[model samples]
Every structure is written in structure tokens, then in C-alpha cells.
Target: MNVKYKLNLDVYKDRNYESIIVAQNDDKSRIIECKLYADSQPVALSSSVTAAFNATVNNVIVAENVPCIVADNAVKITLAKSMLQLAGMMQCELVLSENDTILTTQHFSVFVNKSVINTKSKYEPTGANLATKNDVNSAIETASAKMIAKDSLLNTSTSINLTSLEDTEQIANGVTISVSNNKITLSGTSTAAVNFYLKLKRAVTLEQGKAYCLSLQNFANIANSGCVFYPANSQKVISSSWLLSEVSAFKNAVATYTATTSIIIDAIKVAIATDRIVDNACNLQIEQNNKSTAYANPDLIKSSIKPELYQAPDYTMHYLYVSNDYDEDTDGFGVTKFNSILSANDSITDNNYHNRYTIIVAQGTYTNLQDRYAGLSDVGLVSYRGVMMKDYVYYESENIYNPQATIIKWDGATGFDKSTLKSEDIIKKCPFHLDLNVHTHIKGFTFDCKNIRYALHLESGGTGYATNWVVANCIFKWGGRADCVDYADKTTVPVFGCGHSFGEVGLIENCKIIPTHCTIGYQNHDNADNSSFGLHMKTGSNITIRNCDFCGTEIQARTLKGAYSDTPNTVNIEKCINISEVKKMYSAPAERCDWKVTVDGNEVE
Candidate 1:
């Protein structure tokens, strides 16, 4: 077997030459220059080249059996120290080529001479506390010096994994790190407030915009534990400035939360004592408590307790009827107490009896507004509740000479007198009002005010007016007088003036209002007198007038008085026909909101 010799060559810094070629020498022993390459790319003399290589030398036949001297002698190539500055384990090649023709080759490996700048690296100091205090300080100082050299690299990334919080000292000037049992505090003065969000911890506030990192290991100990960092002027329990005084206050509040739990227990005891929970129909089942009638009757209980006990009508249901043939003593429920217009007013207006009864008026013409039921001039049925009247009011033509006039007996002593129905009569009997005392609802009633001032007048007394009133399917015929000038005057303002005053959320639907006399001084325009409208709303809202007919009435069907310098009120009027304009009636020159009126599927602009 033929044997070929091989040798390993390493190139380092030398004084004689920066690179050398290893080969056989002739008598002259002249050196040959071999080109070097890193991964097939030509490695220049000054440039660094860190790569693996394969080198070889071949004897080129120049003229048939004559070999080239330089190609045969050039065997190995040595790279310079300047060419090994790049970081990496690399392969390099030394090629002996003449005129780009392959001659010989050799292989070798190359690596970095030292750590390179701007290169990827990782610290792996482990096993036996390889990193010391001095080592860390030296690394930091070196990094700081490098950053200072390159002024653009002011922000440097650093990572330190702390096993246990021990070396928490002044790592930098005016900077200190601390660690408690459940917290790691890094305190330092900063130029501005730093945004920090740590799990299960309140945001750390630094004095003079200092920076801090508070690590909360046990989150359960903190109240309202969250990872929310609030900025300047943000909504938070603690504001931007977290002074020492604020910190103390927060600590005190935390203790209060614990103390408040005991106080809540005491408060709950007092609440339960004051409002006793008794057995009611909602809780008790029929099988459990079958004997609960749930009625307020003291005499009935006594009768049940003793068989020999006797009791009169308890008036518990509060039913009062009106009829002509009835005695006040015996026939109490059958209309004796509520026989005439005055007597019915007394029973219905009494605070003890009002809102407690269903006043059923029999079919009759009770034209006694002044001599009987007219106790208060401006108070019709002031603060009344519950249902009133069997039939609203039936008008029967008495005389052809005065078709709008009616004749009635005055208390049977003054004989018969021709009394014209005025608007004050309606205001004196069943006035629609909104207050705490009156929750009046007049349903299925006809108000006949042919010669009266108004059919239905709304006058609110006291601070609060009446509410939740529904007047449905009612007819208001022959409303207002031809000469109700007093209504236009300020003597008795808004008294027996307008047909209906809507002061609350009232639903007036499917009603017909026909006023024969549209009264003088009732226009709602510039340089005009008082205009008596069919439906007048004075500073009211949510009044719905739908599916109603107003035939041959004076002025607008629905009008508004904004009361000047008040907020605009809203009313919905839909699907009504044969009425005048539904607009605002200006009383005085004041700031007015453009009325939101829509008539016949068209908005009034």
C-alpha cells in the first residue's frame, strides 16, 4: 500500500509574514503565494474571514510530463490574525490555481480570535455561583462604557434573574432595590412618571416622578388587586400624586373595610327589627295557610270570635250610589248620602271618603254647581280619586227659546231658575288636577258645558300636580261661552278658561269636543287677544291625543303655552282630523323652542 503524509497547520500573528504557504521547496526554496477563500468567497488580506476550509496542492502538467513549480510547491495556506476577527466556527480553503484552473487543494477550520461586537451571545455562568458581585459590576461598567461611546445607544437592554432578593443595594446612583416577604421594590428617581403594571398590586407612585417596581407575590392580601396602571387625571382610587399622606390614608381605609363589616352586621339587625316580615299572600301557599282572607274588617273578626256579636255595614268596600228616591239614614249605600249634586260632592270630597268609594251617579240633570257643590270657587273636585258618575252628563233640550239654557230647582225653596252652565261649573265639580292627594281618573263621562266656561280644566295645586289620569271615550259638548272675557283676564287666571288643561301625562283618545262658542280674546298670535283652545297644555309633557275628532271648535285643537323661559315640552298628536293648527300660543315675548309638531304625516318646520 502506498502511504500519503498529512499535517495540520494553524496560523497566528507573526512578525515575518501575515500569511504563509506550506509546501515542498526546490534548491532555491522560493515561497509561493496561495489564494485563500472563506466558504468559496475570496478572503482579502485586510478583511476578516471566519469559516471552515479544505486545502490541496496539485502538480499541473505544463508541457507533457513537465509539472508547474509554483503549483506543485504551494501546499498549505495560513490566514492572518486580521482575517480571523469575525465570530463563528467557519471552514476555509487554500486553492493553488493558475489562470483559474484547478491545481491542488487543502482543508482546514477557522474560528474567531476574540469576541466580536454586534454579535449574538448569551451568558451561561452556572453550577457554582459563577457570577459574583465584581463580575456583575464589571459587566455593567463595560456595557455602560460602550453605550457612552455610541451616544445613540443610551437605552440598553439588560436582564438579571434573581433567585433570592439578597443583593438589593444601590445598584446605581440614587437607585435602591428592596425585597420583602411578598414584594420586590425598586426605587429610583426618574425624569417622568413611568407606566407600570404588575399582577396583583396597586400602582406604585414615585415621588418627583420616580420609578418603582412593586412585585406582589401573594395577591390575596391586597384589596382590589388588579393590573391597572392609571395615568395623569385618570379615574382611579388613588390619583396621579401618591404622597406619603395619601399612602397613610389608603392604609387607614383598608382597616376601615374590615371594621365596616361588623358595622354592617349591626345595621342589618336594626333594619330587620324596624321592618318586621309578616306572613303575606305571596309567601303562604293555599295548603299551608288556607284561612287567610286578607281583608280589613275589625267587626267581622269580632263576629267570628263571638257568635252573639252584632255589627253594621263596615263600609269597607266604599260604594256610594246616587238615586232620587232614597233616604240618607237607612239607604246609605243606595244614594242617600250622594243624592243631590251638593250631597254627592260632600261625600266624595271628604278626605275620609274621597278616593275610598266608587261614586255612582244615577241618570239625572244635577245642575247645582253654585247653590250646592260650589263650596270652593276654583276647586271643583280638588284631590279626588276613584271612579265618578254612572253616565257622564246627558243634555236634554228644555226650551227652544234658549236652547243652550237649562232650568233647575235650587234646593226646592227658591223654585225653578234658568241657570246657564258655565265653565266654572265643570271646574267646581270634576277638575282634572295632579297632586299627591288627587289621583282622579274620569272615564266614560260626558261633560255638558254649553254655557259654561270650560269643559275640563286642569289646575295643579301645591308643589306636585295630579298624575296617572286617563280620560277616554268621553264627549265634551258645547264648551265655553261667547263672552268669557274674564278667562282671558288675569283676575282668575286659567280658571274655567280652556277646554282641557293637560298638566301631566294624560291620554285623551277617542273623544269628541265640540265648542259652540269660541269666546272672544282667545287668539294665540301677535297683537291678538286671549284664545280659548279646545285642548290647552300649559307646561306639560307626554300628553298623547290620538284618534280624536274636534268639529267646529274655536282656535286650535291643541295649543301650548311654554310659560316663557322654560324647557320645551313634548306632546304627541297623531291621526286627528277637522281641527285648527296644533301650535304654540305665545303669551309673552320670551325664549321659545321650535314646537315639534307633526300633522298628517308631515313635520311642522
Candidate 2:
């Protein structure tokens, strides 16, 4: 009795969402039937489509390119003995393709239950029957006879017998020929040139405008060796060396003349090539072997036949790609090309909070000069990994290290709408706005602020809190003159700002801040007054800054008073470099915060 295991696979679902259980080494009585669906609809399989089952045991590929029987929307594959060699979990995937183009892939898992009976035996064959020695010898002899008959129709040759040559056949009078041990030798005095022609045993007809390849085997190993051919009943002597300019052809042909030397012509063959007879013979043998009983068995097919090697896919359902110079109609995400980043971000629905996405951005400059902010806002559980500059740049210099190659340039300022003191309203005008319960990551980019107030704003107002965020390997540039200090009408701002009241935690590592203008004193413009600091902190917030470089700034960081006045703000700065003449590393106007600044483990006060 046969047992069937059924599984329903959805293409849009995550990997390993469903699994199947099977017994170990039970290959004969078990089969797996799978029905594939895409977006709640059954996938239609036609005659042009093919499916393959692949599985990995302990991260090593053991079963690759095992064919599956497909009917309509269902696929069935029998268990192979090699796949069940060990009793463990297996990672499996089904690949569907049409005309060699992959349509969709569905991934799942299989658990092989351990067997109690031990059936260990030596010299056990995996096929239906083993071939005897007589059967192998008979197959070899039949293939050899077919190859010899095919060669006779394509080639013609002649043997050289010095004793039977006529006077007219000898071109040089001073040269003489003799035979010993079935070897023909030509001996002559010094200054004697040997050039002669022997009649062919079988006549060969040469057609006009037809090319032929000539070769000689078992001839004398002499320098400048070559041969010439003469057609039947024709006087035209075709020299193989002169007819072909290829050096390989010239080396294979017997030479025309050798001075003062004994030349031995043991055996020689010259042919007119039309097709490869060896390749045809091998293919014929393969066609015959494929009809054998051992090859016909489905269980023995994997060991008998070898297909092309399989390569795993790079990006799966968890990856999204972004590129500016790609067409959406022709390109697919993480397949051949990519689309826009904004489109990739918005495509994630609200119900997919459990899925974490990695947005891969290609190296390019993104600029927005509109009224509203131009970067990603309110996006949670997403990591933006951009292609960095160090991957392409060969030579390192000052300007190359300042602004990264992947840049996000925008002119959004906080002073656009100064009527509202709410943090939510002010964060909408900044480039990057992080809200409550969000874990975001930004890396490998340069935020080019065109004299903007803040490059990033972390909102922490009215039950809102941002936590567990990271900003690494980035640059924050002012994008203005280095000596300009006029700030009468403009609002003074930090590169990054955290709102007051709620608690927050974040980290900034391996970052640089390039302030193009001279530092000015802080001026309170409706309670926004941290002009000289590079990073502004709020009450009840903890931030860690490590391995950073801050230039042209009076203070590195500052903490302001918050609604919870007793809760102190904590800022830890470690292994940071101050290139400018900054007076203090950090300061708290309310004197109710904790600040620790360290350089290579030593505390700096």
C-alpha cells in the first residue's frame, strides 16, 4: 500500500512557513503531492512549464534538480534514497520555470523521522540491476565497430613501399629508399634533397570550392615537416603547408624535403573532414544506455544522470531593491533590476508588521527641493542598506572622505511652519522623521543639508517615543561656505535633534559632521536654541556616540530641560575627535543631566 502526503504551498508566503514529516529510508511507498498558489489563486501549469525539487541537508546541497511530475496546478515527486540518507531536517524548495525562465519559487521544510531498524550492508547498488562483465564488453565492441565504419567513409590513405616505386615517382635522383622492420627510410649523400610522390591505394575525388583538412601520422620527427596532396587524374599538387597558414596545421603534415638525413615513414593518414565521428558515436551510445531498465527506474535516475549544477537565489521574498535608472515594466526587484525606493517602502501593507524588510539602495544621488520633507518618514522595522563609496573609490583623499558617494540632498527646514510648537508638526518638515515604537536603521549615505535646520528629527512628544535606532557610516554636511557666520534671520539648528518629554534610546557610530559656517551663540527662537552643538539631546533620553569626527562646532552635544525635569538626560561620547577649537564637549543648561566623554578609554573633562 502507498501513502500520499499532500501540501498546499503559497508563493507569496514566507520561507519555511509549512513543513512535512517523513520516515527515514522509506523510499518505495511514499510520495509527496503539492498544490501551488499565488495570491490566493491557483497557478496554472502548461506544457511549457517544468518543476524541480531541490533540498539541502545540514546546509549542504544533496538533492538538486530532481524532476517533478506536473499536472495542472499540482506536482508530485517520489522520495529519492539519497535525500533520505540521514535522519534530520531538510530545507526544500520547488522551482517553477517556463522556457528556462523562472516564474516563482516556493520554499518549505521536511523533517525525516529517525528509523529504529539498522539495515547496514556493503556493496549495495542504488539502481535496478548491476551490469555483468560480459554485458560491458559487448557494448564496447559494438561501439568500436560503428566508429571504424564511419571513419572509412570520410578518410583515404596510402602506404609507402620503396621497393615497388617507379622511376617517374622519384623526384630526386640522388636520394634512395629502403624498408626495414616495416619502417620506410630515405638515405642520401650530403646536399641531396628528397622530394617524391607515391600513388594512393584508393582514389579520392575533390570537388571545386570545397575545403579539406590534411594530416600525417607516424612520420619522421623532423624540422620544417609538411605534405602535399594530388587529386585523382589531376597534375595539380596541393601543398598542405602552403594552402593553410595556421602553424598547427603545418606542424602536423609531413615535410617535403630533408637534406642528408634518413626519413622514416611508418604510417600516415590524410582525411577530408565534414563532421565529428567520435561525438556521434558517444551520443549514440548514450541514447542506447538511456533505454536500459536501470535508467528507466525513477528511483535510480538521480545517480544515473547528471544535469547542470544548481545555484541558489540571491534575494528572496524578504528583500526589496531600489534603483533610479531602472524600468518597472521590464525589471523586477532583486531579480534583474530594481525600482524606486519610495515605491518599495509604500508597498509594505500595514498588516505586515511581523516582516522585517531590507531595502537595498543602489549608489546614486537623491535630491528633493519641495516644501515637505523628502526622506522616509514613520517607517518601522526596516533597514536601509545603501551601496557605500568605499566599495568603488580606489584612492582616498580629503574631499572623497567628506561627502559619501550615495547622497540624499534636501532643503527641508524646521522654520517653514513655526506657528506650531508640537513636535509632531515640526518633525514633518525635516528630512527623516522617526515616531513612537519604531526601530529604524540608516547606513552608507551622506545627508546633504542645504543650510537646513535639522537633518533628522526623533519625535518624543505626547506618549510618542523612538527607541532602538542606529545611524552608522554616514556624513552630515551643511553644504554652505566654511567662513560664513551671518545668522540673523535664519534659525540655528543641530545636525540631529531629539524632542522633549518621552524616553528614547539610539546610537550614532562612525559618523562625521561638517559644519561649513562659523559657530554662533544660541538664540531662542520659540524654545528652539541649540545652534553651536552638533547633536541636541532632550530629557529622559539616552544616546551613545562613538568613533565620530565633529569639525567647526562650538559644542559637540547639549541637553535641554524637558517636561520631566527630574529625569536626567544621559549622553556617552567615546573615541570621538574634535577638529575645531570647541570649548566643551557637552553642556546642560538645566544642570540636571549626566555626560561622559572619553577618548580611547581615558575620561576627558
lDDT of each: 0.30, 0.40
lDDT (10s digit) by residue, model 2, range 469-534: 677777877542221134333434666655522345667788888765434211111112222322
Off by over 4 Å in 2: 1-317, 333-340, 350-353, 368-403, 412-428, 462-466, 480-491, 500-503, 518-540, 554-559, 562-568, 579-591, 594-605
Tell me the TM-score of each prediction against the true structure: 0.32, 0.40
Off by over 4 Å in 1: 1-317, 327-330, 333-337, 348-356, 370-437, 461-466, 483-503, 519-540, 554-567, 593-595, 600-602
After superposition on all C-alphas, the RMSD of every candidate to the true structure, in Å, is: 41.8, 26.2
- Model 1 lDDT at residue 269: 5
- Candidate 1: lDDT of 514? 52
Candidate 2: residue 84 lDDT (0-100): 60
Q: Quick one: best TM-score, which candidate? A: 2
